[model samples]
Structure formats: C-alpha cells, structure tokens
Target chain A: DTAVSQTPKYLVTQMGNDKSIKCEQNLGHDTMYWYKQDSKKFLKIMFSYNNKELIINETVPNRFSPKSPDKAHLNLHINSLELGDSAVYFCASSPRTSGRAQETQYFGPGTRLLVL
Target chain B: DQQVKQNSPSLSVQEGRISILNCDYTNSMFDYFLWYKKYPAEGPTFLISISSIKDKNEDGRFTVFLNKSAKHLSLHIVPSQPGDSAVYFCAAPCGGNKLTFGGGTRVLVKP
Candidate 1:
C-alpha cells in the first residue's frame, strides 16, 4: 500500500475555478505538510498540520487553505485559482518524533495542477 | 532571502566514480543540515543529514560532510551508479520548526 496518496494525479482547470487536492497517509504520522514546486523547481512549504492543528503557514496567498479532519489527512483547497497557481503540489507526512527537519519525510506522488 | 543555496545547477559523473554535491547556507543559526534525493514526478526523499556540531555523517555509499566555518556542506556518493541520477536538495532548520531548502542540483550518472 502507498504510504501517502493524493487524488487527481493531474488537475486542469480554468481561472477563477475552485479546486481541492486531497491527501492521506497510512504511516500513522502525527504531522502532514503541503509544498508547492514552481516551474524553476524551487519548493516552498505552504502549510503544516500537526495532529490536525495548524502549525506552519508560510507567506502563501490567502486563497490557499489547508484542512485536516483527522491526523491522517491534510487537504489543500484553492479558491479563484489564477495562472500563477499552476504548479506541482506535493503532500508529505512525518511523525512528530522525526526530530525536526532531520527526520525523514515521506512524500506522495504529487499532483500537477494547471490553471488556464 | 534564500537561506540555503545549491550554486551548481547540475553535475555529471561516470559510473563507479565519486559524485560530490555542494551546498552553502547563509544562516549560521542553522545547526542541522540534510540532503534529499528526488526523482521526477515524485516528492523529495531524505538521503542523509548532519548537525553543525559534527563534521561528517555517512550511510552506506552516501556520506554527508558539514563545514560550519564556511557555512557549507556536501553529499558524496562513492562509486556512483546510474540509479543515483536525480535531483539533490539541501535543507537546514533555522531553529526546530521547519526546513529551508535550496534550489537543488541535478546529478547525472553516465554509464
């Protein structure tokens, strides 16, 4: 079984459309994260949920929001999408004992989102 | 500002040779450093890491060296293999909250 999985491996939509990316982990992790990789291949952390509580939120636009109904899931929802929102979004999870950034992070297959 | 930097956009090495990936940081407050290997269409996977207090750490064929003075660190793969070809990224925690990542360096292993 996949440790982490994301829905809609490839999502293409028009501008102003609302979309959501679902993520789930089976590692029984306590923490989940969302990261966006731009065309330049630079990755930036969007949000992190520790035990279903919001923790780290970078300077991402307010249009993006993360929700965790349970510790095993962290979904990303974007409203009124724009062209700049087109990028590959990755979902990852790790245990609280991962010892900061030193601990290994398990990532999903990544969702490629394209906003026309 | 980018706290971590991988100046080399890409690198190439022959199989059974040494692959040296360099990384530099501007924040001295970063006491811990990590190296992640990424394949296309996949998320970054942790390869190895070292603390500022230590000069080096090794795992199997992969070794991570930390030079605190230069604010630099490197990942070395001995006898590189074609399977080692991938993008390698460096990360460090300013404190304990989150990790700051570099632009990443693409490594190509020639057969």
Candidate 2:
C-alpha cells in the first residue's frame, strides 16, 4: 500500500501560470511536510503542518501557499509561477509531532515541476 | 548557513563491496540522526538512524555510526549490490518536527 502519494507526478507549464499540487497520506500521521529539491540537489523544507495546523514556514516566496484541509491532506498552490520554482517537490508525514525525535518520516514519490 | 553537510556528492562501488557515506553537522545539540535513500524518480525512504547515546546501530547489512565529539555520522553498506545504488541523505531535526537535511550523496553500486 502507498503510505504517501502526490498527484501530477510530472508538471510542465509556462511562466506566470498558476499550478497546484496535491498530497495525501494514509499512515494515520499527525504531521505533514512539504520539501523542495532544487537543481543543486539540495532538499529544503518549505512548510510543515501538525494536525492540519501550520507549524513550520521557511523563507519561501509568497507566491507559494499551502493549505491543509485535514490531517491527511496538504495542497500547495502557486501564483505567477517563476522559472526558478522548477524543482522536485516531495511530501512527507510522521505519526505524531511531539517529543518523538526518533520518529520515522514517510515520503511520497515527488512531483517534478518545470516552469518554462 | 547549512547545519548539515554531506561532502561526498557521489560514490561508485562494486558489487559485494562496502560503501561508506559521511555527514557532518555544525550544531552539537543534534542528538539524533537519520539516513534516507532515494532512487531515481522516487521519494527518499528511511534506511537507518543513530542516536547520540549510542556509537553504532546495525540493521542487517546497513550500519550507522555516530561521533558526538567530531559531530559526524556515517552510513556503511556492506556487501552492497547493484540495487543498493541510490542517493543518500543525512538529516537531523532542528526543532519540533522540522528536519534539517544535508545536500545528499549519490551511490552507484556497479555489478
């Protein structure tokens, strides 16, 4: 069974266009995260949510907005997409978000976005 | 600045050989560490982890070692097979549930 899954595995769009990526996790996790892997292959966390509440928000552009409908779903919406936004976006989740420093995070296959 | 750093960008090893990947961290407060492996067109999967209280943790052919004094961690894959080839990342939780990840080390196990 797929613990985590993201829609639109591959996305190609023109500059200034808007797009959205959807993610879902069926592991009964309480915390979810969104990560971006740039061209340099550096993976960085952009946003995180615990039980459908925003917890972590990195220095991401305002054009990018994340919405968590419930504990199992998180969606990313981008406005006026820029070329630099092209990268692989990954979704991850953990069972709980307390003092469990040793908790394991499950990741999705990733969505490859290309802004032309 | 990047708290976690993986110096080796890539490593190629022969089948049945051993592969070692290293990672360094700037903060000493990081007492827990994790290693993730990612294949092409796929997300990273949890491989192994090590806590500061222990020096080494082993799981089958994968072993992770931690050195608190040097603030370093390493992942060792013994008898690495071709299927073992993937990009490995070392990560540490900064605060709460946020994980600070290293750049990553790509391993190519040749058969």
Tell me the number of clashing residue pairs for each predicted model.
Answer: 0, 0
Worst 10 residues of 2 chain B by lDDT: B92-101
lDDT of 1 at A30: 88
Candidates in order, TM-scores: namely 0.96, 0.97
Worst 10 residues of 2 chain A by lDDT: A96-105
Q: Give Cα distance to truth, residue A42, candidate 1, Å.
A: 0.8
What C-alpha lDDT does candidate 1 achieve relative to the native structure? Answer: 0.90
User: Over the stretch B3-69, how does candidate 2's per-residue lDDT look in tens digits?
Assistant: 9999999999999999999999999999899999999999999989888989999999999999999
The alpha-carbon lDDT assigned to residue B90 of candidate 2 equals 98
> Candidate 1 regions off by >4 Å?
A98-102
Model 1 achieves a DockQ score of 0.65
* Best candidate, TM-score: 2
Error of 1 at A19 (Å): 0.5
